[model samples]
Target chain A: MSKKRIIAVSMVLAMLLTGCGSTAATANGTEEAKVEQVGQDTTSAAEEKSSDGEVITLTWLNHYAEAGKQAWVQSVKEQFEAKYDNVVLNIETVDADSHKTILQTKLASDDAPTIFDLSSNADLQVYNEAGYLADLSDFECLANVDAGLLKEGQVDGKQVGIPIELSGYGIFYNVDMFNEYGLEEPTTLSELKNVCETLKANGITPFATPFAEAWAFSCYPRVLYDAVCWNNDGAFWEKLADRSLKFADCEDFKKQMQTVWDFHEYWGEDAFGTSWDSAQQIMANGEAAMIAHGSWAVDGITSYNPDINLGVFPMPVSEDPSECRMIKEPGQQLVLFNYQDERIMEAARNLYNLIYSQDCMRVYAEEAHQMPSVPGDYNILPALAEIVNYPAELSFSEAGLKRNDPEHEDVLFETMMNAYTGSTFDVNELVDALDTAFDNIKK
Target chain B: MRKIRISSLLYILLMLLAICIFIMPVALAVLTSFKSKPELAKSILSLPATWNLDNYKGAVERSDFLNSLKNTVAVVAPSVVIIVLCSSMSGYTVARHSRDSRALRLLDKVYLASLMIPFQILMIPVYKIYKSLHLLNTLHGMIFMLVGTSIAYSSFLYVGFVKGIPHEIEESAYMDGCSEFRCFWLITFPLLKAISATVAALHTMWLWNDFNIAVILLQKENVRTITIKQFYFFGKYTADYGMAFAAAILSMIPVVACFMFMQKYIVNGIVVGAVKS
Candidate 1:
C-alpha cells in the first residue's frame, strides 16, 4: 500500500515540474521574438531617416547620490534637455566603488551604456583597447579644454574619455586649531614632524588616518612617491609605464614608504580599525588636528559645521620646498559607447557641450563644490576658492596613469599598507613582492 | 530562604550581563540616530546631548520607507503562504507514501540533494530566466522566485513530520468515500499545524530581509524592497550611518513582531520535528 502511495506522489511532483519547464520555454520564445522586431525596426529607420522622428536617448552611468538635494545632476540634466528638445536623457547612478565592477559586467554582457565614467587613465586605456569607447578627437568641444587634462583621457594617440573635474589631495588643517596651538602650516617633512610633536604635546592627535579600509593610506604614499621619485619629470612615468623602471629600484620610493611608516606614531593607536567615517568624525570633533585627503572634503566639512574655519596646504616635500607638486586628477571622465543611431550620438555631444559650458560650470562649482576642468573665473565659496588657488600641479605626475594599471599598480600599495601597519616584512621582501606581481602582469 | 534568594540574585545578574552584551550596539545605533552629524562624530557611543529626530525623519524620507514597507509585505506575505501550502502537501505525500518505483525513489533523492546546492551559483541563471519572462522588476516575480527556492527545504522537513503521523487517521478518511485532496486537507493538514507554523515563521524572516535577489531583480524605485532601499541611502562617497541605523531598526520591526506573536508554534514545531523519525 505504501509503495503505491509513493508512486502517486512522485507522479504529481513530476507533472508540476514539467509544467514549470514548458512555461519557461514559452517565455524564452517571446524574448527572441521581441529582439527580432527591434532589429527590423532599426534597419527600416535607417532607410527612412527623414520620415522618422529624430529624437534620441543617451544613457549616462554615473556615481552620484540620488537622495535629497541632487541639485548637481538635476541642473546639468535640465540645461541639456532645455537646449535640445529632441534629446532625451537617462542617467543611472551607482556607488563609486561599485560603478567599475558593474560597468565591467555590463560591458562583458554587451549592455554597455552610451556614456560612462572612468576613474583612471589606465582604465580608459583598458576600455579603449577593448574598442568599447568612442574617440573624442573629432569633437569640436575638445578645443576649449586644456591639453594636459585631455592627455589624461588619451589612450596611445586617441582621446577616449573627457575630463569632468579636477582635484588636489594634501593635508587640510583646521586653521583655528592651528592658531590656538601657535603653529604655522608646515612646508617640509622636518617641519611637519615638529608640528606633529607640538600637537601631541598639547594632548591632540596630530594626523587623522583611517587604515581600516586600507585604501585611505594609498594617498599618503602616492603624494610622497611623487615628491621624491618623479619631481615633475615626464620620463619617470614613461619608464614606469613601459616596465623599464621598477618602483622598488627608486631610492625616493623607499624614503616615501618610510615616511608613511613614521605616521604610525602620530596616528590613533587603533587607526587600523577606525573607518573613514569615524576618522572624519575624530577630526571634526577636534580630536585630531589635520586630515590628509583630497579637496572633496571641503564641501563635506562645510556641510557638517558651517562655522568651522579650514585651511588647505600642500603635502610637504622632502627636497625643494618650493616644488610642491600636488597630485591632481580629473575626478572622473564620461566616455561614450558605440551606437548606430546618428541622432543618439548628436544628442550625447550636445549634452556633453552643455555640461562644459561656462554657465553650467559655475552651477557645478557652487553646487558640487568641485573644481571645474574648464578655465573660467566663477564665484566660488571663499574657502573653496582658497584651495582652488593653492599652488598645485594641474597635469598628471608620476602617480597618475603610470601608477594606475589595475593588475600591476595595486600590489605596490597593498604591500606598503601591510608593511606600514607593523607587518614584519623586510624592504627587500616588499620590493620582491611588487616586482613579481608586476612581472606576472607583463605576461 | 536567604541562600535561595542569593542564588536567584546571581542568576538574574548573569542574565542582565548577557542582555547588555547583546543590547549595547543596538542602543548605540538608536542614540546615534538622535545626534547631529557633528555630535555623532564626537561620541558615537555616548547618549545625545540634544535630542533630534531629524536622522529618522531624513532616513524615512530618503528611503521611501512607506512604499518599501508595502513592497516588502506584498512579496514576503504571499511567498510565505505559497511555500507553506506547497511544502505541506508535498511533505504529506512523501511521508505517507512508501513507493517501490525507481522514478519515485529518484525524485525523493533529488529533492534532498537540491538542499545542498548553494543559491549563489543559481542567481545569474535565475535572473536571466526572469528577465526573459518580463518579470525582472515586478513584486510578483520576486515572490515567485522566493517561493520556488524555499519549497525544496521546507518540503524535506514536512516529509519527515508527516511520516510520524499515524497512517490509520488518513486511511479512515479515505474509507469514508473522501477524495485524496479532501482527506489530506481536512485530516492530515490539521495535524501538521505546528510544522506549517514553523515553516511560515522561518520563511517570513528569510523572505522579508533578503537583500541579494532584491538587488539583482528589482531596478525600479517603485518596486524596491526595504533591503535595497537601505543600500540606496548610502552611496559610495557618502553614508549617513545614523540614517542607515534608523532604516535597519525600521526593517526589523515587522519580523520581530511576527516572532513575538508566534513564539509558541515556532518552538513546538522545532521540538516535534527534531524528535520525529
Candidate 2:
C-alpha cells in the first residue's frame, strides 16, 4: 500500500512540474521579445536627433567622483544641457579602478559613452591601436593648450585626447621642519643624503614611502627611470621594446635601484605597512619630513591639517643637481569614443569644445584646484608656485616602456622593502627578474 | 553548585572577550566617523575631543544618502521576491521529479554546475549581454541580473527543503480532487514558510551588499546602489576616511535592521538549509 501511494504522488508531482515548466518558458520568451523590441527602439532613437523633435541623450563616462570634482561635473552638466536645449547630457562616474574594464566592455558594445577619461599613454595607445579613439586633431581647443602639453595627449601624432589638467611630481617637504633644522632644500643626491642624516640625528623620520600601498612607492621608481635612466639615452625605450636592451644591462637602472634602497633605509619603521591615508596624516602632523609624491599631495595634507606649511623640490635621483628634474604629466585627459554615428560624434565634439571653454576651464581649475592645461588667465594657487616654476621632465608613469612589465613596479617596491627588512637583497637578481618578466609579457 | 558557578564565570569572561573582538572595529569606525580631520591627524585611536556631526552631514550630502537608500531598496526588494518565487518553484519541481525523470536530474546537475562557477568570470559576458538587451543603467535590468545570478544557489536550498517535506501531506490534498496548482499554493507553499524565509533573508543581504554588478551595470548616479555610492567617498589622490566611515555606517543600517528583524528565522533557516542540503 505504501509503494502504491508513493507511485501516485510521483505521477501528480510530474504532472505539476511539466505544467509549471511550460508556463515559465512562455513567460521568459515574452520577456525576451519585449526586451528585444526595447533594444531596437533605442538603437533607432539614437539615430534620430532633437532636430526631428526628439531629445538625444549623449552619455559621458569619467572616473573622477570626488566631492569637488563631482560638484564641478554637475555644474558642467547643467550648463551644457542648458546651452543645448535638445541635447541631454548624461555623465556617469565610475570608481577609477573599475572604470577601465567598464569602458573597454562598453566600447565593444553599442552602449559606449561619447566621452571618457584616458588613463595613461600606454592605455591610450592600446585604444588607438584598436581604432576606438575619435580623431580630435581639428578640435578648436587644441590651439589653446600649450604645444608641449598637447603633445602628451597625442597617439601616433593623431590628436585623440584633450588635456584637462597638468600636475608635476616631486618631494614634498615640511617647510617648518626645514626651518627648524636650518636646512636648505636639497638639490643633489649627496645633499639629499646629508639632509636625511640631519633629520635622523634630530630624531625625525626623513621620508615616508607607504610601501603597503604599492602604487604610492611606485612613483619613486617611475620618476627615477625617467630622470636617471631614460634621460641618458633617448632611444632606450625603443631598444628595450625590441629586446636588444634589457633592464639588467642598464647601469643607470642599478643606480636608480640604489636610490630606492636609500629611500627605504631612511623611511619610518612602519613604512612597509603604512597606508596612504595614514602617511598623509603623518606628513600633515609633522611626523615625517618629506614624501616623494606629486602636487596632489598638497590638497590631502592641507585638508588633513589646514595649517601645514609645505614646500616642494625635485627629487635628486642623480649625482649632479642640474640633471634632477621634476616629473610632470597631464593630470587627466578627455577622449571621445569612435561611435561610427555622425550625429552622435558631432554632438560629442561640440561637448568637448564646450568643456575647454574659458568659463568651463575656470570652473574646472577652481573646483579641482589643479593647474589648468588650457590657456587661460587663471591665478596660480600659492601652494603650486614652488614646483610649477621649476624645470620639469615629462612623466613616464603611463609611457609604454615604463609600463611594459606590470609586475615590475610591485617587484621593485618589494625589493626596496626587503633591503630594509633584513633580507639578502640582490639588485642584480631583481633586475634579472624584471627583465624575465618583461620578456615573458612580450612573448 | 560551587563548581557550576566557577565554570559560568569563566564562560562569561570568554564571551566578553569574543564580543570585544567582534565589536571593537565597528566601535572604532563609529568613533572615527565623529572626528574632525585635524583631530584624526593628531590621533586616530583617541576619542574625539568633540563629537563632530560635520563628517556625517558631508557624507550624507556627497553620497546622496536618501536617494541611494531608496535605490537600494528598489533594487533589493523586487530582485529578492523574483528570486524566491522562481527558484522555489523550480526547486520543488526538480526535487519532486528527480527519481522518475532524467530531464529533472539533468536540470539539477546543471544548477549544481552553475553554483560552482564564479561571478567574476561571467561579469564581462553578462555586461555585453545586458547592453545588447538594453538593460544597462535600468533598475529593472539590475533586478533581472541579480535574480539570474542568485537563482542557482537559492534553488539548491529550496530543493533540499522540498525533499525534506513529507509527500503524505500533498498526497492527501491530491486525493480530495484538488489541482496541483492549488495544492502547491494552499498546502505545500504554506509549509515552505521556513525555507522561503531563509531564501528571502539570504538573498536580501546578498543584493544589499553587492558592489560589482551594481557598479558595472548601473552607471548613472541616480540608479546607483549604496555600496557603489560609498566608493565616491574615496578619491583617487585623497581619501576622506571620516566621511568614508560615516557613509559606511549609514549603508550598514538597512542590512543590520533586516538581520535583526529576521534573526530567529535566519538562524533556523541556515541550520535547516545546511543540514538538509
Candidate 3:
C-alpha cells in the first residue's frame, strides 16, 4: 500500500477503536435508561410498595421558590426520609417557567420523571389525557382532600394526580400602609374606586400592578369572569370550556375592565415596567400600598419585614357583592405513573399516604406557608392560616377548568390581556380570533 | 475643495453615528448588569441608580466562570493547532498532487462537497458517533470533533493558497536533496503562514463560543463550556437577569481579548488568504 493509503486506514482504525472503548465505558458507568425514565420507574415502584423498608428512591421535581431553597428541600427530604426509613426521597428542582418545556422534551424521549409538579390544572389534564400520569382514584390518602382541589386533578372521571396545596389571590394590602392613609379595604367596586382616588389624592400609588408579566394582569379578568359569568350550575366554567361565552360580551367583564382601567391611573408612572418579583418586593418594602397576588406572597412579605402588618381582602371588581369571585387554582400535585410491579405500586402508595397524612400536611402548611388540601386543624403561620377561612369570593382559574384545552386557555388569556392593554380591536374580534385558533387545533 | 471637505465631514459624522448605534446595546447590558434586580426590572434601559459589582460576583459564582473559561481554552487551543497543521499539510499535498493524479483531484472534490453540508444535520450523527466512542463529554473529544468538521473547509482554503504559490520553490528545494516532507515543510509551510493564521483565528472563535455541540455532548458540570454556563443561569420562570448579563459579558472577554491581541494578524492573514485563494 502507498503511504497515504496506510495513513488513511490507520486513522479509520483508530477512530473505530476509540468509539468502541467509549461505548463500553458509557454502558458500564451510566444508568441503563435515561435520567427521566429512571425517575418514572422509581416513582411508580415506590407507589406500589406497601411498606417503606425497601428503600425506593422517589424524585420530586418542582420550580417553587422553596425548590431552590436548599434549607427547604433538605428539610422536606429529611423529614420524609426520617418518617419512612425505607423510602429515600430525592428532590430535582427546576425553574417553574422552564419546567413545562423540559417535561415535554423528557416525555417525548420517554425519560419523564416518576414524580413532577404541575403548576396549572390545564397541564395536569394534558398529562392525564396523554396517559403520562398514573390514576390515583383508589388511593385512600385522597379521601380527605377538598372536593374542589380533587376536581382540579381529575380528567374525564379519572383522578390522575394528587393535589398538595391550594392558593387564592385577590388584593393583599399592607395594613400599616393602609392605616397611614386611613383607608379601609374596599368591600364594593365603587368603594374600591373611591379608595384608589383617595390614595392618589394623598400622593401615594393605590396599587402596584406589573403588566410586564402578562399573568399579573390575569388577576383582574379572572376575578371578573368568576363574578359575572360563574353560576351554581357551573355554566360559567362550562361556557368558558366550550367557547360558548365571550369575555368581552359579558357586561361583568366590561365592568371589570373599566375598573382595571380606572385603577390604571393609580398604578404609578412605571407600572408597565415593574416585574412580578419587584412588585412583590415593592409591597413588602412599603414602596406600594397593595399588590394583587396569591396567598403565596405571605411568607415573602413577612420575610421581607417581620413586623409589617399585612391584611388580605377579596378583589371586589363586581358591583354586586354576591357576584365577586376570588381567583384560585390547584396547587402542586403528587402524581404516580402506572407501573406493573406490585411491590413498586405499594411502595408509591405508601409514600403518597405519608405525603397526604395530617402530619405531613401540617409540616407543609406551617413550613411552606401553604394551605393544605387535606382537612386539618394544622397550625399554619398566623397570616396564612387566617386567610384560609377568609370569606372572599372564589373563582377557579379558567386554565384549571379547561385543563385539556391548553390552546384555548392560551388564546383566551392572551386575548383578554390584549384587550385590557388597550388593543384597538374589539372583544368580538379577539373572541373570533380565539375561535379560529381553537377550530384549527380541533381540525 | 469646499465640496470635498463637506463630504469628509459627512463621512465622519456617519461613522460616529454608526459606532454609537452599534455600541448602544453593549453599553445597556453593562449598565444593567451593575443595577440590582429591582432596578433592572423597573427600567431595563435606564442608567443604574448605583453601580454595584454584586451582579458580576454572583455571575462568577453561579456560572463557575473561571472553570468554563479554562475548559473553553483547552478545547479551542489544541483544536486550532491540529486544524492549522493538518489542513495546511493536506491542502499542500492535494494542490500539488492533483495536477498529476486523478485520485487527488477526486479527493479535492470530496473535500469541497463536504463543506456544503449544514452543521445542524451533522450534529446528531456526529454526536451518536462520539457517544459510541465515549468522546461525548471530554475536551479532547470536542477538539477531535472540531478538527474533523473544520479540516475540510480549512484544507480547501489552504489548497487554493498552495495552488497559487509558484511550484518552482518546492521543486528547487527537492533538487537540493531534501525529502518530500522536508521540502514541503521548510519551503511551502512558511509561505502558508497567512492562510494558517486566518484559519486558526476563525476556528478559535467558533470553538470558543459554540453552544449547541457543547450542550449536547457535555453532560458533566465540570466539562461544560462558557456558553452552556450562561444558558444554565436562566431557569424556567425566573431568570437571574443580572447574572445572565454579567456572565455573557464575562464569556466574551477572553474572545475579545484574543481578537484585540491578534487583530493585526487576523486582518492581514485573511486578506492574504483571500487574495491568494
Per TM-score, the best of the predicted structures is 2
As for candidate 2, its clashing pairs are none
Residue range with the least summed lDDT across 10 consecutive positions in model 2 chain A: A24-33
Error of 1 at A258 (Å): 2.0
> What are the root-mean-square deviations of the candidates from the true structure over C-alphas?
6.4, 7.3, 7.9
Sort order, TM-score high to low = 2, 1, 3
- Of 1 and 3, the candidate ranking higher by TM-score: 1
Q: Local error of candidate 1 at A62, Å? A: 3.2
Runs in model 1 lying further than 4 Å from the true structure: A1-56, A66-69, A81-87, A96-101, A104-110, A143-146, A230-243, A361-363, A378-387, A392-400, A423-429, A436-443, B1-4, B98-101, B108-120, B274-276
Could you tell me the lDDT of residue B237 within candidate 3?
Answer: 31
Taken over the whole model, the C-alpha lDDT of each candidate is 0.71, 0.76, 0.68
- Name the fnat for model 3: 0.07
Error of 1 at A202 (Å): 1.2
- Backbone clash tally (model 3): 27
Candidate 3, residues A55-101, lDDT tens digits: the string is: 56665655543423334455667777887767676554444544554
Interface RMSD per candidate (angstroms): 5.5, 6.1, 7.2
Indicate the worst ten consecutive residues by lDDT in candidate 3 chain B: B231-240
Chain B superposition TM-score per model: 0.92, 0.96, 0.92
Clashing pairs in 1: A2-B98, A3-B98, A3-B99
DockQ score for model 2: 0.35
